[model samples]
Structure formats: C-alpha cells, structure tokens
Target: MSTFLNLLVYGLADGAILALAALGFVLIYKATSVINFAQGEFLLVGAYMFYTAFVVLGLPLVAAVLVGVVVATLIGVLVERFILRPMIGEDPISIIMVTIGLSMLLKALVQMFYGTSPKSQPAILPRSSVEFLGATVPLNRLLVILIAAVVLTAFTIFFRRSRHGIAMRAVADDQQAAMTMGISVRRIFALAWVLAAVSALIAGVLLADISAVDQNLAGFGLMVFPVVILGGLDSVPGTIVGGLIIGLLTQFVSGYQDPGLATVVPYVVLVLILLVRPYGLFGETRIERV
Candidate 1:
C-alpha cells in the first residue's frame, strides 16, 4: 500500500542518521575499549557550532561544516589527552563515572552559553519536496539518506584499506599484539575519539537539518546504544543494519499503531537483544581455551 511505502521511505531516511550516530559509539568501543557516555554532548557541541557558523556568522554551509568538524575533533582529542588519559589504568566503573561527570559538565557549559531554549536551524540544504513511488518526500531527507550511504561506504573502505584503519582493527583485537607490531595503542585510542567526534558532527548537522537544534539533541546519542548493541558493538558495518532495523521498526510501528510506540520500540528491542543475543548479530565471538 502507499501508506506502508511512505513509512518505509521515511524510516530509511531516519535510519541513515541513526547509523551515523551509532558508528561513533562503535568506533570508540572497538578501538579503545572505553565507553564514552559523553558522546551525546559532542553532538550538542556540533549542533551549536553549526548554528553559530551558519546562522550567526552567516558563513557558507561548507565552511560551517569544516569549522564544526575541526572544533569537535579538537574537543574530542582534548578529552582523550587530558581527561581520559589520566585514568588509563583505572577500573571500568571509575572511567564510566568520569564520563558521566564529563557529560554533566559539558551539558552545563552548553546550557550556560546556548541556554535551554531550542533553536530552529537554518535550511542550509535546498528546501523542496519530491515524489518517490507515490510518497511525497522532502529533498533534504533524500539528500541525508544519500550522504549517509556515501559516508558509510567510504568509511567501510577506509577501515578495510587504510593503514590507520588497519591499525585500529589490530588494537581492537589485541592491544598487546598491536603494540608488539609497532602500533601505538595510545595514538590509535586518540584517533578513535577523533573519529567518534567527527561522526557526531556529521550526525548533528544532518539531524539539525531534519529537526530543531536543541540541547535535547544530546538524547539522540541514547538512541544509538540499542543500534550499537543490536548490530554488534565491534562490527562497523553492522551499524547500518542495526540503524536501519531500528529506524524502520520505530517508524513502521508508529505509522501503523500509536505514535507513542515509536519512542518505546528501540528500547524494547534493546532489552530483547540483551536478553536473547547480548553479543549482537555481527559482534565478534571469542573463546578462551582454559
């Protein structure tokens, strides 16, 4: 039916953003084994930066994107070097606590500067509607979907072909072995954070284009945990799968049933995944011969 098709298109479009956001979480977890609860704040930072650049300074969109990325990457690197680095040997709980603290601190800072009020983003991309298979759709949404696909493909190739990407894989597999092979584990950790931050920037910009830019944009990162878990925390490409699955499921349910179901579906799926397949669909399985 046309209605089903409409929901499907919208779902796929939204999934693209989910995949982008979850990729950041996966990158940090895969490389450094550190869970970054502050990842959402990075999105907050990106959205604000884009707002300042595009709306306030009236810079060109491309220039604004570059500015957001640079600033976000710098913040990520700083967090790794100054905050996370000092707790390298600390227990996992301590690290998690630190991340929580960092998130709160970042949120407070963002509030102080940007305030709690939501700001509608300027339409950087062209504003137009197009018909797709009997469904009316926004051109911006289509562009976002295309951009997400391109970015995902490019990163997949980078991970498979690039030296640093290979190095990251090596570290993720075995830190000791990677170091033995002359790979700097510390450097790779920093790179993971940088990549994570950059991913957040892209997600933030795309999301702002779709919705209002606000502090609540930070919550988008929470939606990513389910995607990461469902796709496999260590699997890079699985992000797309998980993102699509969740995005489609939420949209489909909300479209067919009650709108309230949309927000609850991801969490329900998350719990089920935790109960049934905690390792996730594409997550690597390891066995220890005792």
Candidate 2:
C-alpha cells in the first residue's frame, strides 16, 4: 500500500510536468496548424538557460527563472518571426522539416555552449519527506504537484476569460473566419509560440529540480508526444488527462515490472492508441467530404 502511494505521488508529479510540456505543443498546433518538432529543444534550451543563470551566474532563484523565461520568450519570437514566418504558405512537410532542422540546431547550440554533460541542479523545492495517507512523499514532489496545478489553473482561466485568449481560440477554430472577424492570425501565432515557450520553460525548470540538468532533459520532452497524443493533440484539457495517465502507468510499470520497461511503455501505449483511436481519448474527430 505504501509502495502504491509512493508511486501515485511520483506519477502525479511526473504527469504534471508532462502536461506542462504537452500544453505548449497543443497550443502551437491549435493556433498554427503546424506540428513543432522542436518543442523538446525548447525544454532543453529553457533548462540550460536557467542553469546558466542560477548555477553559473549565481543569481537568486527568482531572477534565474525570470532570465530563463525572458530568453525563452525571445527564442519563441525569433523562431516565429524569422524561420516560421518565411515558410507560412509552404508545404506542411517542408514546415515539419524546417522544425526538425530547428530542433537539431537548438540542441547543437546547447551542446556547443554547455557540452554534453549533466550538471548538478540546485533544489528549488524543500528536499524533505512528509507522510501522507501512510505514504512517505517527498516534499519536493508534493510541491511540484502544487506548482503545476497553480500554473495549469492560471492558464485555463486565461484561455477562458482573457480577450487575447479568446482571439487565440477564434483563430484556432477558423483562420479565415478569424481573419474576417478582424483577428490578426499572425499575432495569435506569435502569442501561441510565446505561451508555448513559457510553459516549456516552467516544465524544464521543475523537471531539472526533480532530476539533474542534462541534455537528456530534451529526451524527457519527447515524452510529451505520447501525452499529447493520448490526451488529444489539439485538446488542452486532454493534455492534463493524458499526462496523469501516462505518468501513473510509467510509475506502476517501473515499480512492479522492470524500470527499463517503463521507458518503452509510453511508446507502446502510443502505438496502441493510434491503432485504436488515432484522434486520442479527448481529441476531436474531423470529418471532411472528399
């Protein structure tokens, strides 16, 4: 029972981070209809930026976070403006190829600057354990869950109530109609990238806090694909549901089976989900008359 409880807590924390990463992916897809292969690289860049600021420059935690966010925002804007903007009307395959190139470029840049090594990440959350429901839960893990909840809630409110958020949704629904309504699709695209970058930044920092700052952080970001696919590629709420499911499943597999199996399980689930429901659990089904 205690083991199960521990796994539950750990899984939830992992899922929260997954959801954060996946949220950005969903936002970009919804707003731009473009799948960003470089989303994981964003996570890598954000984590490294935070590491440089906090560990290298010896800045306060808050300041380090701000630095990371600002840098990520800039990266988002630059990518959208310079790289993506030029290819706006290009073939989807070309856009995807460009993003793949972008990912490699970003990863190479990080490697060039930081080298391919793991750095000791300072603990931002309390590194203690607390008993919950007869289970010993790491205080840091609990704090991660709390922080992710707050951030997700804030995003949900923004999407539901804010004017810009409504415009974003409008654009996502129909670009032509949104344009007719006087909504700037280009501006929304930029905003989507910015939001995605910020979300990835937060997820990267939280993940680094739990683990170490390493190039493998980007690999963790790749796991967001399974989460978003499981939840629904364009469904924001689905990201949360998918994240929790994947997180719990990974934990359970690792605990009861081999830890190695946990790594393969998500992809396995991805395949099964694709075969059974390509649209995902909460993804909307589109029907077009050919």
Candidate 3:
C-alpha cells in the first residue's frame, strides 16, 4: 500500500508537467493549426536561461524565472512572426518540416553556449522531503502539483471569463468566422504563441527543479504527444485528464513491471486511443460527405 501511494504521488507530479507542456501544443494547434515540433526546445531554452540568470548573473530567483519566461516568450513570438507567419496556408507537412528544422537549430544553439554537460539547477524549491499519504515525497514535487493545479484552474477561468480567451475559442471554432467578427486572427496567432511559450517555461522550470538541466530535458516534449492525443488535441481539460492517466500508467509500469516499460507505455496508450477513437477523448469529430 505504501509503495502504491508513492507511485501515485510521483505519477501525479509527472502528469502535471506533462499536461503543462501539452497545453502549449494544444493552444497553437487550436489557433494556427500548427504543431510546433520545437516546443521541447522552448523548454530547454527556458531552463537554461533561468539557470544563467539565477546562477551566473546572481539574480533573485523570482526575477530570474520571470526573465526566463520573457525570453522564451520572445522566442515564440519571433518564430511565429518570422518563420511560421510567412508559411501561413502552407501544407501541414511543410510546416512540420520547418518546425523540425527549428528544433534542431535551437538544440545546436543551446549546446553551443551551455556545452554538452548537464548542470544542476540552483535549488529553487524546498529540498526537504515530506511524508504524504503514506509515502515520503519531496516538497518541491508537492509544490509542482499545487502550482500546476492552480495554473490549470486559472486557465479554465480565463477561458470562461476573459475576453481574449473567448476570442481564442472563437478563432479555434472558426477562424474565418472569427476574422469576420473582427478577432484579428493574426494577433490571436501571436498571442497563442506567447501563451504557449509561457506554458513551456513553467513546465521546464518545474522539471529542472526536480531533475538537472540538460539536453535530455527537452525529451519531455515528445511525451506531450501522447497526452494531447489521449485527451483530445484541442481540449484543455482533456489534456489535464490525459496527463494524469499517462502519469499513473507510467508510474505503475515502472514500479511493478520493468522500468523500460514506462518509457514505452505512453506511445502504446496513444496507439490504443487512436485505434478506438481517432479524434481523442474530448476532441471533436469531423465528418465529410462525398
């Protein structure tokens, strides 16, 4: 029972980060109909930036984090404005190729400056472990869960009440119609990219807090696909639920079975979900008449 509880605790925290990263993917897809392959690179850049500011520049933790987020957001804006914006209306495959190239470029840039070694992030959260629900867990892990929950709730409220959020929903529903309604589709695209960067930065910082900062950190971005696919790519709530499901499965597999299974489980789940429901759990289904 203790072991089970421990797995659950770890799983929930991991899922929260997954959901946060996946949120970035869903937001841009909903707004611009593009899947950013560079999303993970955004995480890498943010984490490294935070490391530099806090450790190298000796900035306060809060200021360092904020600066990292701003730089990440700027990267997103520039990418959207310069690279992706011009490619508007291009084929999905072409856009995908460009993003793949961008991810590689970003990775090379990080390596050039940060080198190929891992760096331990200066402790930003409490290092002490606390017992919870029969299991000992790091305080920082609990903090990650609380922060993710708060952010998710805030996102829900924003979508429901904020004017910009409504406009985003409108654009997602029908870009042409939203433009007709004067939503400024282009501006919404930029805003979506910025918000996506914010999500990536938050996830990156939290993950860095848990582990060390390195190239491997970006690997979490690939995990986002399973979460988004299971939850429904365009459904924010689905993303949260999907993250939990994937997180639990991963923890359970690693705990009881083989550790390697944890890495493979998400893709297996993705295939199963796709086979049963191609549109995902919350994603809308489209029908075409011939």
Candidate 4:
C-alpha cells in the first residue's frame, strides 16, 4: 500500500542517519575499548558548527561543511590526546565517568553559546516530493539515503583495503599482537576518534537538514545506544542492519499506532535483544577460560 511505502522510505532515511551515528560509537569502542558517552554531543556540536558557519557567517554550503569537518577532527584529536589519553589504563568505570562528564561539558558549552532555541537550518536538500511505487517520498529523504549509502560504502572499502584501515582492524583484533606487528595503538586510537567525529558530524548535519537544529539533537544521538546494541557493539556491519531495523520499526509503529509509542519501541526492543542475545545480532561472542 501507499502508506506502507511511505513509511518504508522514511524508515530507510532515518536508519541511514542512525547507522552513521552508531558507526562512530563502534569505531571508538573497537579501537580503544572506550564507550564514549559523549558521542551524542559530538553530533550536537557538529550540527551547531555547521549552522554557525552556513547561516551565521554566511559561508557557502561546501565551505560550511569543510569547516565543520575540521572542527570535528580537532575535537576528536583533543579529546583523545588530553581527556581520554590520560585515562588510558584507568578503571573502565572511571573512563566511563569521564566520558559522561565530557558529554555534560560539551552540552553545557553548546547551551552557553547557542541557548536552547531551535534554529532554522538552511535547506541543503530540495524540499520537494516525488512519487515512488505509488508512494509520495520526500526528495530530501531519498537524497539522505543515497548519501548515507555512499558514505558507508566508501568506509567499507577503506576498511577492507586501505593500509591504515587494515592497521586499525589489526589493532582492534588484538592490541598486543598489533603492537608486536609494529602498529601504533595510540595512533590508531586517535584515528578512530577522528573518524567517529567525522561520521557523527555528517549525521548531525543530515538530521538538522531534515529537522530543526535544537538541543534535542543530542538526545536523538542517544538512540545510537539501542542501535549499536542491536547490531553488535563491535560489529561494523551490525550498525547498518540494526539501524535499518530500528528505523523501520519506529516509523511503522508511529504510523499504525500512537506516535508516543514509537518513542518507547526502541528501548523495548533493546531490552528484548539483551535478554535474548546480549552479544547482538552481529556481535562476536568472547569466551575466556577463567
């Protein structure tokens, strides 16, 4: 039916953005074994950065994007070098606390600078609709899917073939073995943070393009937790699968049931997935002899 098709398109678009955000989370965990509670704030900051550059400073769209990417890269490097670096070798609880604190700090900084009002984002994608399979699909939504797919594909190729990508994978597999192979674990950690930041930045911008830029953008990023958990915390491919499943489910529930119920659906799925398969659909199972 047309209604189902519309929901399908919307769901795919939402899932693409979710995958982008979750991808960064998985990367940092894989490389450094750190659960970055601040990942959402990264998206928040990135969105605002793009808004400031494009709207406030009147920069061209491409220039604004570049500026956002540069700032994101710096934030990642600084966090890895100054904040997270010192906590290396510390207790996992301590690291988690630090990240949680970082998230608050980043959110506070954004609030101080921008306040809580939602800003009108410049339209990057055309605000139009097209008929597809008897369903009216927003042109922007279709563009979002295309863009996300391209970016994800590019990353997949990089990971499978590039030297640095292989090194990153090597480090993720076993830090000690990677070190013995002459890979700098520290460098890989930094790279992971940088990539994560960039991916979050793209997701933030796309989200803001679809919706208004607001504080709630960070909250939306928190949805990544359920996504990565569903897909597999350390599984790169899991992010995509999990994202699509969650995205489609949310849209369908919102369309057929109460919109309010949609908000709770993801968490419910999260709990069920945890009970059924704690390792996630694509997550690896580790068995250690005690």
Candidate 5:
C-alpha cells in the first residue's frame, strides 16, 4: 500500500512536469498551426540560461528566472518571425522540414555554447519531505505540482478573459476571418510563439531542479506529443488530464510489467486512444462531404 501511494504521488509529480511542457506545445499549435519541432530545444536553452544566470552570474533566483524567460521568449519570437513566417502558406511539408532543420541547428548551437556535458542546477528549494496520505513526498515534487497548477490556471484565465488571448482564439478559429476583423494574424502568431517560450522556460527550470541540465533535457519534448494527442489537440483542460493519465499509466506499467513492456507503455496507450477516438478526447471534429 505504501509503495502504491508513493508511486501515485511521484507519478502525479512527473505528470505535472509533462503537462507543463505540453501546454506550451498545445498553445503554439492551437494559435498558429505550427508544429514546433524545436520546442524542446527552446526548453533546453531556457534551462541552461537560468542555470548560467543563477549559478555562474550569482544572480538572485527570481531575477534569473525572469531573465531566462525573457531571453527564451525573444528567441521564440525571432524564430517565428524570421524563419517560420517567411514560409507561411507554403507547403506543410516544407514548413515541417524547416522546423526540423531549425531544431537541429538549435541543438548544435547549444552543444557549441554549453558543451555536451550536463550541469547540476543549484537547489532552489530546501531538501525536505512531508508525509501525505500515508506516503512520504518530496517537497520539491509537491512544489512542482503546485506551480504547474498555478500556471495552468493562469493560462486558462488568460485565454478566456484577456484581449490578446481572445485574438489568438479568433486567429485559431479562422485566420482569414480574424484578419478581416482587423486582427493581425502575424502578430498573433508572434504572441503565441513568445508565450510558448515563457511556458517552456518555467518547465525547464523546474525540470532542471529535479534532474541535471543537459542536451537530453530536450528529449522530453517528444513525450508531449502523446499527452497532447490523448487530451485532444485544442482542449487545454484535456492537456492537463491527459498528462496525468499518461504519467500514472507509465509509472504503473513500469512498476508491474516486464521491463521491456514498461518502455512501450506510452505508445500502447496512445495507439489505443487514437484508434478509438481518432480526433482525441476533446479534439474538434471535422465533417466533410463530397
């Protein structure tokens, strides 16, 4: 029983991280229809930037996070404006290839600047644990969950209430109509990219605390695909719930299944969901008649 509780708590924590990362991915996809393959690289860059500011430059933790987020957001905006915007209305295949190329470029750039070695992040939180539901939970894990909840709630409100958020939604619904209504589709795209970067920075910093920061940090970006698809591409709430489901399912499978089966658990779940729902749990349905 203790072990089960421990796994559940830990799984939830891990899911929180995954969900945060997926939130950025979903935001970019929803607003601009651009599948950013470089999303993970943006995260890697932000994490490393935070580490450099906090650890090497001796800046305050809060200040470092702010700077890192700003830098990451700028990087995101520049990439969209210079690289992606130029290819707008081009073949989807061409856009995809360009993003793939950009991802590779960012990876190489990170390696050149940060080197291939991993760096340990300075601990921002004190080492501690608390007992909850008859299980010992790390304070850091609990903090991660709380932070993710706050960020998710804030984003939901932004989309529902804020002017910029409404504009983004309009653009997503129909670019032509949005442009005709005096909304700048280009500006909305830029805004989406910037927001995605800020979200990635937060996730990266939190993740760096849990583990070492290195190139491998970006690989976690791949995990977002399953979470977003499971929850439904455009559903923000679905992203959070789907992330938890995948996180818990992965942990349970790893705990009970043969080692090999554990590795493929996510794919198994994704395949099953795709087969049944096709559009996903909350994905928008499209009806076509010819």
Candidate 6:
C-alpha cells in the first residue's frame, strides 16, 4: 500500500511538469492552429539560459528564471513573426516541415554552444524532504507541483476573464471571423507563441530542478503529445487531466511491471485515443457543410 502510494505521488509530481509543458503546446495550437515541433527547443533554451544565469553567472535563482522567460518569450514572438507568419497560407505539411527544421537547427546550435554533455542544475529550492501521508516527498518536487497548479489556475482565470484571453479564443474559433470582428489574428498568433514560450520556460526550470539540465529536456515536449491528445487538444482542463493520466500510467507500469513499459504505455494510450476520437476528447466536433 505504501509502495503504491509512493508511485502515485511520484506520478502526480511528474504529471504536473508534463501539464505545464503541454499548456504551452495547447496555447499555440489553439490560437494559430500550428503544431509547433520546435516547442521543446524553446524549453531547452530557457533551461540553458537559467543554467547560464543562475549557475555560471551566479545570479539569484528568481532573477535567472525571469530573464530566461523574457528571453524565451521574445524568441518565440520572433519565430512566429519571421518564420511561421511568412508561411501562413502554406500547406500544413510545409509548416510542419519548417517546424521540424527549426527544431533541428536550434538543437544543433545549442549543442555547439553548450555541448552534448549534461550540466547539473543548482538547487533552486531547499534540499529537504517532506513526509506526506506516509510517503517521503522531496521539497523541490512539492514546489514543482505547487507552481504548476498555481500557473494553471491563473491561466484558466485569465482565459475566462481577461480581454486578451478572450481575444485569443475568438481568433481560435475562426481567424476570418475574428479578423472581421477587428481582432488582429496576427497579434493573437504572436501572443500564443509568446505565451507558449513562457510556459516552456517554467517547465524547463522545473525539469532542471528535478533532473540535470540538458538538451534532452526539450524531448518532454514530444512526450507531452499523448497528454494533450488525451485531454482534448483544444481543452485546457483536458491537458491537465491527460497529463495526470499519462504520468500515473507510466509510473504504475514501470513500478509494477517493467521499467520499459513506462515509455510504451503512453504510446499505446495515444494510439487507442486517436483511433476512437481523432479530434480528441475536448476537440471540437467538425460539421460537414455538404
């Protein structure tokens, strides 16, 4: 029983991180209808930036995180404006290819500068353990979970209440209609990318805190596809729930069966979900005009 509880706790902690990563992915998709394969690279950049600022430069952790987020957000905006926006009327495959190319290029650049070697992240939170319901949890893990929850909650409120958030939603609904309504669809696209970058920064920081900082950290963005699909591509709450499911399923599979199963389970689930509901759980059901 204690063992099960332990695995569950760990899974929840991991799910929180995945959810943060997926949030950015979802935001970009919802607003611009672009599946950003380069999303993970943005995360890598933020983590590396944090490492450079906090560890190498010996700046405060908060300051480092802030700088990383700002820089990453700007990069995101620039990518959309310069790279993605130009390809706007292009085929979906072309856009996807461009994103793939961007990911490869950015990753290679990072490897050239930071090298393929992983770097240890300075502990942002205290190195302490907390006992929760008979399970020992690390303070940093608890912090990650707490921060993820807070960020999700704040964003949810913003989407529901804020004008910019509503504008984003309008743009997502129909770009043409939104433009007719005087909501600059282009601006919304840029905003989505910027927000996506910010989310990546947060996820990168949490990931670095939990493990070593490295180029591989961006791979989490790829892993998050299952979570996004499970939650419903367009549904924010679906992303959170999907992330939790994937996290717990992977943990249980590895803990109870074999470690290899942890990685495979998410793929199995993704395939099944896609087969049954191609649009996703929260995805809008398309209507045929004919």
Considering every candidate listed, which one attains the maximal lDDT?
A: 4
**Model 4 residue 263 lDDT score:** 92
Please give the lDDT score at residue 275 for candidate 3: 99
Clashing residue pairs, candidate 5? none
Clashes of 4: 0
Model 4's C-alpha root-mean-square deviation from the true structure amounts to 1.5
Regions more than 4 Å wrong, model 3 = 286-290
CA lDDT, candidate 2, residue 91: 99
| TM-scores of the candidates in the order shown | 0.96, 0.97, 0.96, 0.97, 0.95, 0.95
lDDT per prediction?
A: 0.87, 0.93, 0.89, 0.94, 0.84, 0.85
lDDT of each residue in 1-290, candidate 3, tens digit only: 87887788789999999898888889999888998898888888878888999888989988997888889879888988999999998999999999999989999999999898998666788989897776787788789999989988888888899999999999988888998988999899999999888888888888888888999878988898999999998889889999989988999999999899899999999999999987799996665688
Clashing pairs in 2: none
- How far residue 111's Cα lies from its native spot in candidate 4, in Å, is 0.7
lDDT for residue 39 in candidate 6, whole number 0-100? 77
Question: Residue by residue across 1-290, what tens digits does model 5's lDDT show?
Answer: 87787778767877887888888888888987878787787778878889989988889988998889879879878988899899988988888899889879988988998899998776886569888888787888788889988998999999999999999999989899998999999899999888888888888888888777888888877778788889988778878998888878887777767657755777877898889986778787765798
Q: Write the per-residue lDDT of candidate 2 for residues 1-73, one digit (tens) a residue.
A: 9999999999999999999999999999999988999888898999999999999999999999999999999
Tens digits of per-residue lDDT, candidate 1, 18-82, equal 89888988998898788888878888888898899888888888898889889888988998999
Candidate 1 lDDT at 183 equals: 98
Candidate 6 residue-wise lDDT, 1-290, digit = tens: 76787788778878998888889889988888888888788778878888888888888877887888888878888999999999998999999999999989888888998999999766787778888888786777778778999998988998999999999998988888988989988899999999888888888888888887987787876878898888888888888888888988998999999999788898899999999987677776766799
The predictions' CA RMSDs to the true structure, in order, are 1.4, 1.6, 1.7, 1.5, 1.9, 1.7
Minimal lDDT window, size 10, model 1: 120-129
Q: Model 2: which ten-residue window has the lowest total lDDT?
A: 280-289
Model 4, poorest ten-residue lDDT window?
Answer: 281-290
lDDT of 3 at 171: 94
